[model samples]
Target chain A: MADEKPHCKVVLATNIAKSLLEEVQDGLAKIGRKPLLVGFLSSTDPAARVYAEWTGKTANENGFAFELREIDREELEDALLDANNDAAVDGIIVYYPIFGNRQDQYLQQIVSIDKDVEGLSHRYIFNMYQNIRFLDHANTKKSILPCTPLAVIKILEYLRIYNTILPYGNRLHGRTVTVINRSEVVGRPLAALLANDGACVYSVDINDVQQFTRGEGLRKRRHEVHEKPGWTLENCLPISDVVISGVPGDKYKVPANLLRDGAVCINFSSDRNFSPDVKEKASIYVPAIGKVTIVVLLRNLLRIVQNKIDAAAEASRENVSEAVQTSES
Target chain B: MADEKPHCKVVLATNIAKSLLEEVQDGLAKIGRKPLLVGFLSSTDPAARVYAEWTGKTANENGFAFELREIDREELEDALLDANNDAAVDGIIVYYPIFGNRQDQYLQQIVSIDKDVEGLSHRYIFNMYQNIRFLDHANTKKSILPCTPLAVIKILEYLRIYNTILPYGNRLHGRTVTVINRSEVVGRPLAALLANDGACVYSVDINDVQQFTRGEGLRKRRHEVHEKPGWTLENCLPISDVVISGVPGDKYKVPANLLRDGAVCINFSSDRNFSPDVKEKASIYVPAIGKVTIVVLLRNLLRIVQNKIDAAAEASRENVSEAVQTSES
Candidate 1:
């Protein structure tokens, strides 16, 4: 897999174990309390059930208590509230694609922010995106980011290229990364995260594919002072070092010819956004693997739960100190 | 200005007033109440003070009660809390570019969501972005969006080109639009808004310009099925019908030669991202005229204030009816 192409390497799901273990150890140290996670699965979606089952299995294997509850759409809020109130239930995740339109988000939003390991609440989304927008300097403390994007970041971290500078001063810090889809779940947040890490991210959508052709009217807007001209994918890809795609479909969204040799590609969607022959021309190819994703998801859940426990402990200690001080006074 | 180019049309500050007035009237009918606005400025930033004064002047001219208050950074939270507690103050705006690192956003975040005319709070940011992501189909009602992005939207509405389809089936819906900067105040929010409105948005950062070049190791990960390839600015702008820029520096971020003929360019930045000569090639050139932007900003403030008032009135009525029912029972 590592010798697939001139510079391309293929990473498998098993390669994530070391990183996962490290995360678990860190979480254990930070979280002084046992963690229990409840996965809310609706019977209407078989896919959701499979994902929940996988999560549950992973959770149990990782020394965390995990349970999958079969829930109806109407009972989702009640289930969420119950889990939220249950002291033992440290985290709650409602699986995606509920039967009714908008029902998935509707139920997900009701999950309490503290227990929202999936980061579905508006508060989490806002803080995460704001943190990204402000270059991570914004004071909004985000507990957990969405699983898919976080997983992608973890994958890059595992690759040892996300932050490390190369001998030539090349790194994600100044690299151009194109995200082939703009879905809120994966592409959008991932782009923001990459941008936050100092990668120049260009987002592409298929519906607006027609707008890329060159014509007479095309020109870069110039100011009185001199600056470099703007870019398009046609001009951008020839210089790109990495391409990350999340558009799910049965068509090649990225051509092999567009990529230069030694560039990396990471796909996190159902369909191949890149040409199969891309391996022949690229440095690395990382397809979205469910097993790896689940591990990453579990890692994030544990981290969040541990943070919550630590926060609670710190608050309690502060209260105790306040009471003791009052007595001394 | 109109004759500067064959295709270019320069829209002056006055062109927006008609639409602004129409929006105001419709808002009044929908709001069904008078509104009050408060502008908060820190003494540390001179630019913030000027903007606040302009906003106050516009607010008073538009028949809404407006006040500008200069405050110290330490008093920001207190002032915000006061505005939040004030029942009569329907809208509150904190002038931007607060001195010190991240203090602007910190103070902005303190503004109440109901009175966040500037959309600085995480709640407002999340709701606005989510609203855009869900294409306004999300049930989570948004009280207000970031003023600058909302102003851009209103400008498109005034142009009558945002939603209306062209003879070739091209509209902003399926067109490509490029944003020159990624600032939270304008670029990021505008991209989200445009994406919500169905346009494919490409964000460009001049500081991160080096990343766009194609190099070795570029490849896309493929799935069992295939899809089309992704794009960059070189491919995107040739087909773009509109370009919105918000890079605020003396240097030109976009060159006139990168845009297509007849494409409309809207610059919300102080410096012209587009060259002065771009008027000859583009269909329309809309500069960041202070007067026009102030009007748009005031219009958004008025709309948000009215919405808050209406919501308050509705809540009051519901409470009254509930009280009556309890008495009768």
Candidate 2:
């Protein structure tokens, strides 16, 4: 019986991100210019430094330019404003926890929407939560979703989790997903993204567990939320088709026994959120999603560049029309 | 037994709104000037015209100057721009469903943040969804909440549904609320607001049901979402301590039998969403919240006026310091 026990596949993010990175490289080559991503690092946290280095390396290898600006916490506001004004800087990312409070939130708004590669700015965040897909009335420019959440989405797609035969927005219909972190940047937004795509998303954290779903109706774009009191991992885990964890602590591990058999498990946190034996329960287990996140970040950068180009072209067209009208008049 | 079913207390929104209206009136008097609110009406909908009339009457009664600008749908863009540039206009309201599509959404963005009395502007909506309370770094200016949602919150507070004993921001800590409607302008934002204040909100619409809850930790302000697959009104109603409904169709009724005994019921729809016998199961019932909603709108106008004053003062203070520095140098 022991010899007959099935060994599940362990998937790597690097393998998943390979084709996406190439696609991003192709996108950049077509754009005909290396979009410069300026990253502001004001934190002394070693993890922040390492993440910035990883981003720089990823950007360089993928037909893009990455510049890390190490500045004092006090100078971050000025640096962000400068970057916002600089046409050369196509994207901006700030290493968070600089002030580590509401002040940090204020800092997020300083990066203009046009250059917000991480999609942390209010405009993008608003469009995302509202499930508004495009930036303009004409729907020419696609809205950018936050990198980590978007990466998880891409991973789910690559895994054939999203039913391609279903309508575009309802691809995750009948799917049940449990996201174990509700952090504003990753977990909450990721849940919203999934729910908007027609999944029953259980968003879990230390405080409580909440469920997210898109309301019925073809017109409903944004997801709605409901709270489930006294619900624990014990209740949700066994029912979840996919369990995604991003709890950032070394001591924490998801109990394999609670997970549904053959469930797909994913971890986005820097720390491992599952035991080595998680594969015994999970049909496909992803230990990390960092590489995929970098790819998504670059994809967002290309999107910003494309949006700019589209806007400029629109402006030129408007100007030509104006000139023709003036001459006719 | 039918007679012994018990008569629940009925609360009128007019009585509830009285004190708030007085407070707003006093606020306006203190400001020493009537804040002009310009409303743009392009729709032929009689409901829109009646609402415009109500707004004008309410504004006049509460020391606000209300002007209704009836224009063709084609001219609404120019009208909004004029109102935005006209500093005399302290707040702006546009009767929606003018185009009744994404174009209506485009029109919503035309209302400037500083003067958006409806709080439909992306900035405010984003902040509201994110649970961001203040608009600026200094925390001096309070972010505006959409009037209808804010009205529901106020009614909840008036009914003591919010546990005032708990610390602020966690007032609804143990409450289970079911809101039957996920309309963008009301139900969705209302659910987010309730969950942010610590209620377990079951946001129900025609299509599906969802759960909304704020995560644990004192620092977490925004509410998270989760989807409840196969959940219906029957599943949510009996568990809900409070049932708030805004379904517009007269045919749509929340079956009384499904409601929890002693549940608080409130309706904000033009059409009542509960049956006459709802009072039997309800400990408290509010048939309509339109009066309270108008009061909240005026309150929002006053707030916008106050924000402008504060901004002007800050500007002068900065100028004074700049002048002092110039002299010292």
Candidate 3:
């Protein structure tokens, strides 16, 4: 009887990422120039080095320029400032955890908002959390979201998790999601994004579980959070329609038996947060989303370039209007 | 049998506000000068006018200078820029709903961060939501909170709702709060603040309810939000230790029967949001917190002045260090 049970479909991010990469390639072709993305590397971590290599390979192959600048941790700030001022640099991203303290956070703020491809700056973070979609008052420019979280959202959409029949902002209405991890960079923002789209999200962390929802309304800019004091993974898994995990520890695993039958499961952690048997219970499983995340980073770079071009065009139009007015006067 | 039950204690904001006002007075005396707070009024709303009058009176009485600048809605941007440049103005507050849309939000961003006594600027809002307590990297300057929400926290503290035995940042641990309103200015920020302090807050609005909480960890910078699907006032009230309502409707009321026995209740709405019978169920009932809000506004003004002084001193010290380094080189 157990052998007769259907194994869940395993989805890889490569195909999804390839299509998105094609879209980026098309965008770059229209621009007629390779937009330079400068990557700041100050960490000795092998993982960071590997990620940088991958980013460079992908960018160079896909009609974009990628430059990796490896510098000492102490000189990273000066390097960042130079990158920010460089006319050729369209976007900037730094491999984080250089100092692994509040100082690292300070360095994030050092990246200019205009060129910050990582979207870690205060302005972007604030806009994302507040659900402000546009950068300008007139809504001409769209605000950038952090790439990793945006990657998760894109994957979910690709998996047909977001219902298309529903209205634009409330596409995930009636969906119940459980997100494991509360990290500021990835997990927290992912949960917020899910909730903003109208999913009831159980934001499970090491300490406790919290529920994130937008409540039934079109006017809500962002999701709301509620604390679930005594809730455990066991408690959430049984009720969750979708389970997303990003716990960074290799030893940590979400027990497959705990998941609701036919529930969709996704993991974004570098370390496996789910066991091999997750497919037995889950209707769909995404093993990794790193490829999608990289493409999203490239997408953000393109957006930065587009925003700059738009601003310049707007400025020129204003200048022409002012000149005409001055001549009449 | 219900007749024997004791009526709850009625807590007034007057005494609490008086003490806080004295603290502001002492702060001004130490500074040896009054900090001027400029209020921008473009709304024809009577409530705005009365509030402005109250602000002016309270500010003058508490050793602070207040100026109400009535201007056309169209000139608000220029007026805000003028106040931002004015050296005499230590703080600036704008009466909201001037344009009653996204434009009003734009006006909020127009006030300079240094002179934004209302704490509605992007920097303060971002800090508040992220639970970043300091204005600067060195943690010398404390970030400011919006006045009305700060008043709610102060009221809760006065009621001894915060457990002193618990560690700082976790004093509101084990508490369940329900805040009925999700307005950007007060309800949402108040929920975030309480959750950051380790309380389980169910943030309710006209459309729906969401829970806000910081998972049990000292390292958690801000509260995570969760959506509560199909949750109602009846579902939350019995579990909540505190019920706070700021619903701006004359007929709105929190049914006394729904609240947990001996629960604390507070209403910041202009209209009474709770009935007289609520005293029978509540341990403490606070009908208003307007006085406390005004004093908090004044306190924010003092903080702006202090932050400016600190920045100037730090700049001078840096200059002295640079001069010494130049001579040595």
Candidate 4:
């Protein structure tokens, strides 16, 4: 299997191994493309008493072999920089905790963009801009779309939303969505992406909700720059058709009690210790944000990874091609 | 003044005349800085026409001065590339048309970051992400804020919307804003930015809108990926207290007839002409779509542009500095 070309491989990067990651890896593996669980483990996942047993359980349950590996934090960035097609990695899955100081920069510093599992890197975002304006398809194989954003599309799918809901009044034309906690990696980046998908975007800082957008023109009272440059928690919340929140450990912020009644909330805010209260309030909470729609993002991620090896390989191949071309010329 | 010894000189590229360009140049011309306009139209500006022609009359009386030159269309991109401060041009303006083909990529390409007039390049946007997560200043000059976003900030100066509005009982935020187009020139990127600034962002595309985010949880939607995607324009409209629109041209299908009465509409749509009905309805149409704010935009634009040049210069200077240090050592 390692020698053969992969349809796609999922490189799951996380703080620890979990049943969801195993289920996904096994599910894909059964279908031929397995997922690599790159996470913090008590031991080698396959050797760990629990996972080794779970691996057998999950693999048999899904009809394929599940693989797991532990990655050193110090080596992660270096490994990312040096990754290539022959490098034994295909896609990437990042399951990280929100509390660490280095977590944010580390995630931002080296997204597995070259071999990105999801198109969450700067390059992919740039590619998205290009695709929208220039209609050019780039990094389709190597670009990784953020899973949360893809999940939003999935939510629309759950409701059976489609193009027919146009000319203004139906599904969500002229819609505006304000994302709280813009820095919550998945939520903020995903918001911009959702807007690009065709929704109007109202992004507010989770902390300083009104720093960028002051509520004027509309009926809301927003502060002036001269008076105060920040927004309080009160200035942050507003009526919305739906909410996609990933700010965890703050159940009070997204509990059933906090949401506008009837407003659907999709919780991507799950951690290892899933909260019953949070889940109860959430319209839906899942281990994977959205699966099928991730195809586009996955393809983009593969392309970037492939290109790294392709560039070097292509460079050497250029000599042979040049010889052939020289004769023709 | 053009010939005077300069601390530094950066090029200003815009869609306007060289004279108005010069006024900007003169205002910013201090001991170590100079702004050179890429193109100059002789007959228009007051500073250029009279140089001191009194009364400030007739609105068209003033002619602008300063260094100016115009380049042809095909050569425009090339001029920008040449102006990329390889030690020749300091910075570039690369102005957008009052109304023309989307100039986002064109703008990004010319921005060159630190040398970016206002650090409005793709590089800078990602840099902002790093800053958001790390709380580190971008370390470039102050010339990087996009003009439109800045204007919005300036608008907040007088209004103080955040201060006036009270958040809801559920910690429900006040107003939400939804901007439709994500043209790099203005739209999705801005939305993403606003997300970082902190607003709940619910981005939607035409199809996503058809799938209104009405019912269900995040996971329930995640599980429904097989369902079709649809969208309605109204679905994308902000349900919050405020709505800001920056879509350019007539193709923007935001049905004005559907706008909820009392919703403040700030239109950035310009086609050199407005329908009689639109003229009747708009509460405020910022003439030239924040063109007056261009000067402020220029402040960032020039800063980024100079930063790029300075960065390059510094890199080279470091080599020299290294050599000197080596010699001393």
Query: In order, what lDDT does every prediction score?
Result: 0.63, 0.85, 0.83, 0.40
Candidate 2: Cα lDDT at A188: 96
**Cα-lDDT of candidate 1:** 0.63
lDDT of 3 by residue, A54-147 (tens): 9999889888889899999999999999988999889998987788889989999999999999999999998887778889999989899999
**How well does candidate 2 match the true structure, expressed as C-alpha RMSD?**
26.7
Model 3 off-target regions past 4 Å? A1-5, A217-219, B1-329
Q: Write the per-residue lDDT of candidate 4 for residues A235-289, one digit (tens) a residue.
A: 3333444455556564435434454422334445543212445343332233334
Candidate 2 to truth, TM: 0.51
Winning candidate number (DockQ) = 1
User: For candidate 3 chain B, which ten residues in a row score worst on lDDT?
Assistant: B1-10
Highest lDDT scorer? 2
Which is the better candidate, 1 or 3, if ranked by lDDT?
Answer: 3
Q: Chain B vs. true chain B: TM-score for each candidate?
A: 0.81, 0.96, 0.95, 0.54
The interface root-mean-square deviations, each candidate in sequence, come to: 16.0, 20.6, 20.6, 21.6
CAPRI-wise, candidate 1 is: incorrect
Reference-based TM-score of each model = 0.45, 0.51, 0.51, 0.36
Residue lDDT tens for model 3, B105-199: 98888999999888888989999998889977888899999999999998887666664534566567546789999988789999999998877
In model 3, how large is the Cα lDDT of residue A299? 96
Between candidates 3 and 4, the lDDT winner? 3
lDDT of 2 by residue, B115-196 (tens): 9988998999999998889999898899999999999999888776664434566666546789999999899999999988
Chain B TM-score of model 3, please? 0.95
